[model samples]
Target: MTRRGVIAAVLGSAVAGHIVLGVVAGGAALTAIRAYAAPPAEPVFPAPARPVSPIVSPRWSTERARNDAGEARTVIAALAPLNGRTVADIGAGEGYYEPPLAHAVGRKGHVIAEDIDAATVTRLARRVRPLANVAARLGRPDDAALAPASVDVVLMVHMYHEIGEPYALLWRLRRSLRVGGRIAIVDADRPSGEHGTPPQLLACELGAIGYARTSSRPLGDGVYLAIFEPRALPDTIRVCR
Candidate 1:
């Protein structure tokens, strides 16, 4: 007879003591459980509201940044103690950061070049094939798919804004960090599509995911590098399906 009455009738009898909700449209049924018994989980920061950047070849960005008045050296310095350690290059376009990572970690160490696109990973695999220490792997939009406690450093250069699911991704990153490991994010203060993430917002999102920003400095030539360490106890991460 009424909206509430019809909903109750459809969800009737089965949920005796609990609240129920159902939506019927075009002969399709969608049922939802409304257990108001306990408080709902808190919401995490939403993804940035900005245009997504077009994925480009690493040849344009990778080496150029390296040549910029020691930008590459400064980034490596922030991720210090990387010798003989494992590193991940999230969104490793064209294997741009792989060579440096491989060199820094040395022959005893390994580098995981992870990208969300299969083609990108394939190309990166080919690009880094010359380096014995570097390998490429495909990653998901919401997860980098890194092994637990397997990486000493994770680099997200000019790519944090391109991530579709930052909260889930950042949370997943926590599972990849070893003790004393660090995350280095490089970007400018411009809008997302313009190739940058505001340092304050970047810190806030990472902080929400249980990362503590240890230091930040100008990455030379406008880009900024912020370094963060994982907290001892991570907060309950919100999984984005």
Candidate 2:
């Protein structure tokens, strides 16, 4: 073949390869630009809003109710010595303990059964209406509806850990107690296995809220009881069960 012919063939091949390379590069750049312009994917679903009131349905669950009842009885026994005295049962579900507590306090002493749920409040009111000494209270998210420094005892049975705002509730409870008023916290001793707060964490949180750990004793095979009181009060005011 002639030298010119060979040179022309080589030059033609080089131009063709250059064109192919340019096309590939342009295609890749276009793909990248398109990917960059695409919008981000939306979330699968929106998160539900935080509730304003305590969840009542969870309290009425069969297992929870039974646990609450047993803990309520223990709390009653602990406060039994305070006969004919004012008591407030915070988070009183289904009024299971309100009736007996009202009876213990007698017609003269007052019992405030406070629940955050309006439905639970209604149930409590119906259960305690016959008793003149008992008053059903519907609580707000930030505070209990009880009168400040009016209650001689505050009972929170198997319900403290479930509170959405523990610090706010504890502060309100502290304010509600009389000079020598006592606070009782009863909860499951063992781990719930669910993602609920553990008993030790409850005690620690209560202690942080100015409550002194008075006693921690066994309630049943797997359950335990803890009693706490304001650190400023005398030791005799807070009784351990």
Q: Which ten residues in a row have the lowest lDDT in candidate 2?
A: 232-241
lDDT (CA) per prediction:
0.75, 0.66
Top candidate by TM-score: 1
Provide backbone clash counts, one per model.
Answer: 0, 0
In candidate 1 the C-alpha lDDT for residue 17 amounts to 26
lDDT per residue as tens, model 2, 1-241: 8999999999999999999999998996665443223122321221112222234352535756666657556667766676779988888887767777877888678888888888778877887888898888888755786776688888876665456666556656776777667888666654433323356666666655557777777776556667776653222222111
Q: Give the runs in model 1 whose Cα sits over 4 Å from its true position.
A: 1-51, 56-65, 232-241
Backbone clashes (count) for model 1? 0
- Error in Å for residue 74 of model 2: 3.3
C-alpha lDDT (0 to 100) for residue 187 of candidate 1: 87
TM-score of each: 0.73, 0.66
